[model samples]
Target: MRSIKPTHLRRRAFPRYLSTTTSAQPHIVPITSLLIANRGEIALRIHKTAERLGIKTTTLYTDPDASSQHASCSPHSVGLGAADGYLDGERIVKLAKQHGIQALHPGYGFLSENSAFAKRCEQEGVVFIGPPAQAMADMGDKARSKEIMTEAGVPCVPGYHGGEQGEAELLEHAKLIQFPVLLKSVRGGGGKGMRIVMEEGEFLQQLKSARAEARASFGEGGEVMLVEKYIVRPRHVEVQVFADKHGNCVALGERDCSVQRRHQKILEESPAPDLDNVTRLELWEKARTAALAVGYVGAGTVEFIFDKDTGDFYFMEMNTRLQVEHPVSEMVTGTDLVEWQFRVAAGERLPLTQKEIIERIQERGAAIEARIYAENPERGFLPDSGKLVHLRTPRVSEDIRIDAGFVEGDTVTEAYDGMIAKLIVRGQDRETAIRRMELALRDYEVVGLSTNIEFLKRLCRSPAFIAGDVETGFIEKWKEELFDPVVVNPEVFVQAALGVFTSHITKDAEPHGESLGFGTNSSERRFLFKSLDVLDPKGGEEVEVSITQKGNNLFDARILRKDEKAQVFENLVSSSAFAAGKTGLTTFFPHTRIETTVIEDPNNDNKLTVFQTGAKTELSLISPAWYERALGLKELRASVAAPMPCKILKNEVKEGDRVTKGAPLVVIESMKMETVIRSPQDGVIKKLAHKEGDKCKAGTILVVFEEEEGAATAR
Candidate 1:
């Protein structure tokens, strides 16, 4: 890829459509070129709309994402070194000016809600395609937003949003609000900087952790914290509103974002299911009132925590920018919200009135969107970071939309959000939409790094979710079932073995020599037994697979257990009839067909990684002798290792420190979440491997503990 210098791209003359019109028509500021001030899927989303409007798009990327899919979509892109560069308002403004950008679109996250960044864009004479600076400042702070909502006649949760900033005062406020309160950073919006204190005994510790996280995430603004009464069994619902400079504002119904993990939304659907008409109308009315109260412009979301059983709702906070789940709203309303933001920023009146928007919502039906993240659900949903070797989404149709940030071969690094894509589908009703989403998730395949694809599928198919009985605590309530270990059927193991065996024979075959111990003579190639150890994400199992070659590219396979005699339980399979690609393989059996991707494990020549139906399994083709040797190897260890790549935030224990079982030895931060490493047993710390500020990879020992004398004997 050739690097294009910024100097070579100069400002060109504006087209007639973007030029100022002098007729009696409504005066509008023409924007011919836009600078996308964010990265990933949202940036690409904005560029698509900009291109449709005949606006040239320019994007800024971090060094790691310089060649990312979003970067490739834009005709002009500038490489910003790292996170700091992307958040540098002055640097971004300078680049926008140099590139002759007419407007700057902060595509959510990062500087999207930063009032200072918006002000900087305004100062640079570049249209900021969002709300005015004052609106952001008013609603950007959670505590302040609650006050504004209350003043605007919108119901707000009962809590302390006062100016007091002391820890004691906050604790006292929590006591007044009763136990089981929430300590949240006034400046925080995602799940970051938020903690739930369940009792008096845990208040102080929770407060300290929350404050530290707040300071790390929000900096100076994080110094102030707010205490709120925790709503039990609460449903997270937010209303999407759009406004224009012409004093017209319309609420585009509501979306239920209650399906969450760690307070971050994973699934969202528009026109909240099973909602009463009265409550729905009230939500929209209050949302409209709030938008008008702030003189809001462009797209924004007003979030509320609704008590499902009581039919009561309270204002939580307002996002003064486009949201991650805006696609659900777009799917149901048939509106391109990005285009709406651009037109509104250009001083155009809303294309539709409030009544018209509501009517459109009723006509368009239901839509649901499931966020596809590059994280492991079984491993405490720890975010995974690495290259995406192979990526595939469900077939795109009018009802199915795949908004992805990364592509095949792109890397999902630890420096950014783990969201790889969003699967959005529309249907005539909620049930239809739910079924469509489940099918799409099954079809989505991502190889190399772990993802929440399987978990999402289970969640979608869960009885509670399908029945629309969901809340913010849905995941917690069904944790056991959602994270249950996947049981790979014996058939799946046999299929994977055959896939690798066939691939190896085809690629490494000699004209007339023996292959896979199979003699060239047809009569002698009756049955070949291959003892294999198969490893899925959960665990590994050993089994003997026998195959009989019937003809060229044809074979019959079966699993042989040590205790039982080998028997063929399935019909023969012809490999030549199946579709096999470099990265993907399709196998056909008697009653079922399985599609999978096969990749040779680089570290082990005999091992192959197979991806089927969103699950990854590793197959190790080894002889019985090797399998016996592997089983005899001891795997016990005395060191506490990092579960994932992260920075060592703090070492709670030093060398020679005595610790009991489950004692936290160190704290590490990964993908914005902090995890503490705990001792596996009572022991003495023999060594400390890493220190604060050190970066460590998965399995890097952080602390080495020596078992107490006779500890193993005692166990």
Candidate 2:
């Protein structure tokens, strides 16, 4: 194979990043043109590496991602023209051949781990930048993978890997394994198609639900599940392994992804905190053994469930592609894994042997990656989608990396994953890393949709986490502190009052007032302040305030509250970063100047969000609570609504049906994950607005409860 370095490749520094490089090998056919068969941040991430390596690339985008940044990053492009186009491997492979692209890089997710897709790429003579098709097929099946790992002398979770999946037979297996067993689908990944059966009575019900979700997510093949002994306190540790065709494989290092939500990792760090060097080396050896067992090649991750109590670890699963949290490993190791993938795919030998791979490590440091998602962490991490509207990211430097697929104004549709970006920070040690992460989260901002930024900030400062005590149940264990109600400062109320006001103060300030200006001395502006996570304003945590603006927009602000001293803020110097751009609103108060962005709610003129630093406080103009209650404002709080745009998988309740609090009323599927919407209280269903198979947007009422007679009589 003759090597060819095309001229279309431009040598550009990867935006404050430079990947490790290697000399050209004579036995390699340099892939001058590549096609990225993925979308979102991963796609953009790949494109960056490809460009840095002087390789021309092509990217694919679906209809929803047509306007996405990743779609336009590549000089060459293709449109899938459908929402689920990323999963259409056949079409992707054909497009690669049609575009004369020499290699196709499946940057995780979608068809990245699909063995059939890898085989198709091989058949088309297009280099697939991943493990061999056989490796993927061998490790793709969770049960089979366990069997192979056991044969390879790798410790695996003790469980039933047999074909008898009937509830009765599974129950027998569970009995042997004891209570609190894990029911995992053979085809499960990313927390789908799995459930925890804590006791015998709930075994069958959990099994049924798991099977249903598995069937929906992975088709009929997902119906087959294996039972395993559940680890009460487990730390999710995974090793990054790379292999080449010449029978060489090496472990980059291990990462602790114990902090997760819904079994999906949210925070990941390298050199897993508090791990002993001896066990760490063993982990790497075991990971390599597992990789070599399947004749693996390219980038792969060997996940293990580390028993915190016993110090024993078992193989959990193998992800046969680059991972989302790969950046942390890169930051700590100072070796570009993506560049290695490209090199290995081009038939080059491993850049460094096992000894060199270990020796090449720079000075010791720690790196952590925080995943920012368009989800409300307070509300069970429900998915949220909308236009980015406003986005301000932390500065990207040598130690700080922001990998995102969307910019301001781009929309986060419900057709795909809700992850917005990844904030990766590196420091001299774990303590430094945690501190930097907290500060980074403080500088990051996002509006127009709820995000997990605030939740992550709390986790960064969490005592348990700071002390290096991490487990899969960390979030739930620190639930109260992590979800503590945010106290809105009284000064923020002044900011809110100055941030937005009406035109008429005394039945009129002047019929013609500056649209952006505040009200007068008697403005009597009434606004309620609440954190974005508070789903309903009726929550007792919310604060109601009345502000009377005497001067310009926040020029002179006086705040008064019950039992609180009246504070006056004068000389409210203000400036905007961009002319008429929603990006900036800097206001200087008496004590300090705060960066604030006030975004008027598109759906409601009376509602607005004031973004301070990175925290966002939502304020809405409303009548007094008593008056609104008397007039029946916004519907009663006796309804069940879809947390996100989703397809109703099953309606478990009907009109006139009575349900107890927490009883399942409906199951809705969003992006292939199913969530059961339960009754908020014990009441009879007054109406069934949506049934099975209906698609509804977020906040769409699915069921309304009949008003209670006692409450009604009081009204």
Candidate 3:
């Protein structure tokens, strides 16, 4: 309800460009307050830049994100309903007007590329901090953009970008382009509404799925589709370009986004690795031409699919808005792109020329960015959504930058993308940057949900990645190494046990400020033996540990193996409780010091949650009697369940229908990806719970099966 104001307004120390023949410079629009039409990290990112420019920012939030970090980043926050609130253009423009917002910045998603929304802002007399509406319409559609690129002398991939909408006609074009062609929505971006048909037999099914996703994502413009040649093992690269209303355009540089999973980029770096000087220049030139052809007026990205083996690159599409990976480009160029966007939207000319931009890139060296997502890489990279019980980022440094959206206790719901944060690092060279990123990832920690942190670490250390041999299929090629189960070392478990024990003792002894003698010696107190059941992907291990005080904040800890021989391992270690309100313990050994985050179960104090090296280990301190009872319980039944909250698009079976193993039973859509739930065995459908168009939650059983007689059932 109250308007937000910047804490302080400081003039930026940048050169002011003078107008030609300065007889009172021409009128430039003044933007005092702006509204960011997006949410999460991007909203916070835009707000910070606006604050630095002495511009107040107003941010809109869905009901779930009403208390999110982004909402609090700006005091002028509006709570819109959960569903379709950010995407509602008219309401957003009205809110902007009510708050006296001079400009609107659509941060890289939602209505970022929607031309209608831009036109609406223009109609409302509010400046849109992006490209012109005409340019967005011309470049937002994949088919039209390819046509424009070809006219501008930019090489384009051979495909069908026709105006036909019939399924048969599109199928004919696919055949002409040959098998393994790509089906894409004309207005799609970020891998939505895109599918690859490897054979003719699977064309129609993929087309339907692609169309469904496109319709859900793009709405009105989703009716049209385009087909392209699916380049095998090509490098995904894009050039960042900026244009001013004065017709001056410059291409910053290229970012290699080849490492991907599910067609979405996970890693991106500036000054694409292994690119020849000649090829890089050509890429920049083509990108500039593409932007000029569209009369681009703000920040845009020209994406190209590059064949590394042949050094051939073709324009894929141009994103008519700021990209999510713009931070890496900024680090490599020593320029704040968001600031440029603000200035350009106010009808200001570019501060630097093409030559100056190139010089900055050369001086800044190399930079890399890794997107940290709350997803399970081993489970087909399926997105995970839940509350972040604990979150800790590495300390920010000159060379290291962390752009995060969520803090501790923030919930990662299924309403948006799974990305938690982006970790970017810069160095004097490429190898140094890679090593810095690895160390940064190891220092990053998040619990209460699955993440790809460990997977990113292995990827950075991969030999092929180090050699710069990357392609769009890099993750798929190295899936085995990247998805291998992590082996939690015994020392980590010991450290966790020590951390938990120390915290418990310190809490109990806080009131007296002295030892509570339960044993014969008053100074030396003995704690009961605590059995920790360590659970992992590999079975489980039970270790009985006991501690006795020896000196000030020093204790003798002993570990006994419950299985096989009663082997005893004893060591004298010094441990101390961390500060109040902190969730960790500090342990000092003879040669090493260990710091770990230890979370105890609120209901059961004996259980501990340890976050170590980006992986979570649940250690349940149990009694010998409870351990026996826990092991005797039977495991739950395996049923076909929804991986995430999604609407059932198709139901291929009914109750009592007998199905064979691997038969597709249902199709569900979530987060723009279609997952086909198939039968695990030949069995009769005992229960068909949901119908098409009905929404279901993750772990909700869609179909339950009763095994057929004499049929081999494998789960």
Candidate 4:
């Protein structure tokens, strides 16, 4: 096996391809140029397929994403400022018309599912690279789509899809459906405006909460709510369907997206594991029927909720556009869905029949994709945004691939989703696919902000996940193993000490950029660092790492932790830090050495983020008389702080309101999700820093609690 090298990550520029072969059949109005009306990884995904097909492409980017690779890598691009925005279909269509673009591809978010936007594109003589407006309109509403599915002979979950959505009317239906009912908005997707009521007593509160969120997310279209029986112990499976101008529709394959957090998928794999041939055939038949009934002409996904124990399934909803996990299906089927979209919109026939697609899928192997997001899984999966100081991803090969829109030094703003990239791998079978995914995740590294990489690694290693036993509640079921308690490993301190020692030694040593400098230490070097972060910086357990110079780049290093054994390690090579790069180092521990990256926070030298085996560990370098350090450490136990940068939607409490533990204090909306800030304990509100509609950064105090009898409360 070849050792991988880390570098600044970026997608290479693609040239316009020219094919030599001629078409065998005639096609009308072939798309010569296209405008991608989206941003981030999805935009780049479309661009790559278009480039390979010899089609000209244009992309749009807002001010916040000026440096994004998706916008810069395009052959042609138009920059939209903060005011213009990606949601303005009129502006995008006008730009398309002005540039002589033949078609416009709305890549999955923003305006992809907007039926009105698709109609606008048609009226302006620009082909919309998606299904017809009628198809999107019918399936965009959950209630109406359920009725259509039932009429088309597709099995749907039992629900009340009537026009009457009054609070009293819905409450009566909840009783008819029994306890543990689901409240969903008429126009809902992406888990917004949806809530689960576990009992009859909690129906009304959950309804009101769901309604408020629905209205906020979908406007007037979300005013109506529907009631249905919530499926317990269910697995999420969706089938990929494609159609053309001809009267032929086929199911490409199926993917399992059961592993999720907060109702969004994090891991997905093709050829859903542990299912017999009979179930797969049934799954495909229903998915094809649902798409054909609505005249779906382009790419679409029909989602289903499958009973884990019975193999019975029911239609959940249908996505009118491409899904984020489409890559896995493509990997198994040997298809380029974006290219198919271009051909279908240009009045072409289906490339293959149903039997041909299924045969191809069977011949190919299994594939899995893991979504890499800029969020902290340990902190309730809160979205995080900041500049990526350092970023490295696994190299793409025959078995591994990476799709991304950001590179090193790019800023991840709160104006859009926090996805960094998608890591995909393929193998001969299910077990091989899982093993490949695990190794790929262990090779990915990131810095400057929190991410879910470590959590993803743990998920790939879980026994249940390995055995293909997974469902929607997999994370909650395996939380104990996924979120293991942080134990500062002794290897981390040794790696950090060597990195620090070599970083100063190599200030002018550029000859051995791949190895630590072979320079002699002028004097004894010592560093003061803390093993873990505490409320008081001065009153913390300090770790002492001492270095005594022996010769050129050779030294004796000792680590002394509070109330622990004193351990010592010496250099195996001339330099204590053996294999070293500008941002990485390998420290020898008597018998073995491991690669570690030492990154000093650009803003503060006292803050260090050490990467060991692709997992990040944070330690603070203690500087004496650090008045500034004390000021930055907030009283986390006495105040409720914002989890991330977001706008306050509402304040649920007054300045002097008394609240019990778990009481809602504030409601905030960020990254298209609503979260309620709750009281950590019983206390009275002493102050509120920001009011409703105010924008605040992460760690900004939203509510401060008064000390009651010397006991503190916070969130």
RMSD of each: 9.3, 8.0, 8.2, 8.8
lDDT of 1 by residue, 123-221 (tens): 889999999999998999777787788787888888888888787888888899998898888888779878888898899888888877778777787
- Per residue, candidate 2 scores C-alpha lDDT tens digits across 1-715 of 1111222234442121112233443368887999998889999999999999999999999999998998889887899998989888889998998889999999988888888999999999999999999899989998889888888888888789899977899999999999899998988888888898889999998999899988877776889999999999999999998887777778888999999988889999998999866677777878888998898889899999988877788898899999998998888778788999999998877776666556444475899999999998888998889888677899989999999999988999999889999999999889999999999998876777889988899898889999999999999999988988776666666555544543233223332212324433243444554434364334533445555444555455555554677666666765444322243557777788787666655565555567776676766544355336534553454677788899988889878998887899998988777888887677898888887899999878888888885322111
After TM-score superposition, the amount by which residue 549's alpha carbon in candidate 4 deviates from its true location, in angstroms, is: 3.3
Tens-place lDDT per residue, model 4, 1-715, is 0111112223343211111122454366888798999999999999999988888999999998888888887878899889238988889999999999989999988889999999999999999999999999999888889889888888888778788878889989988988788888878877788898899888898888888888877777686888988888889999998877766688888999999987788999999998766677677778888988897888999999887765568998999999888889888888888888888888887777777776787788899999999998877888999888878788798778898988888988888878889988889898898898988887877877878888888898899999999999899999888877566677777667667667756665322111223345354566666754322334345677776667665667778887889987766342434232335765556777677777767766666778786567778766554423434443334888898999998899999999998899999988767889888788888898998899999878899888666445343
lDDT of 3 by residue, 439-493 (tens): 8888877766678887898899998998899999898888777765555555555
Off by over 4 Å in 1: 1-26, 509-539, 561-571, 576-595, 603-630, 656-661, 680-684, 707-715
Which residue pairs in candidate 4 collide?
none
Off by over 4 Å in 3: 1-26, 503-568, 578-583, 588-591, 601-608, 613-635, 656-666, 678-684, 707-715
Poorest lDDT segment (10 consecutive residues) of candidate 1: 13-22
- Work out the TM-score per prediction: 0.89, 0.89, 0.87, 0.89
Ranking by TM-score: 2, 4, 1, 3
C-alpha RMSD between model 3 and the true structure: 8.2
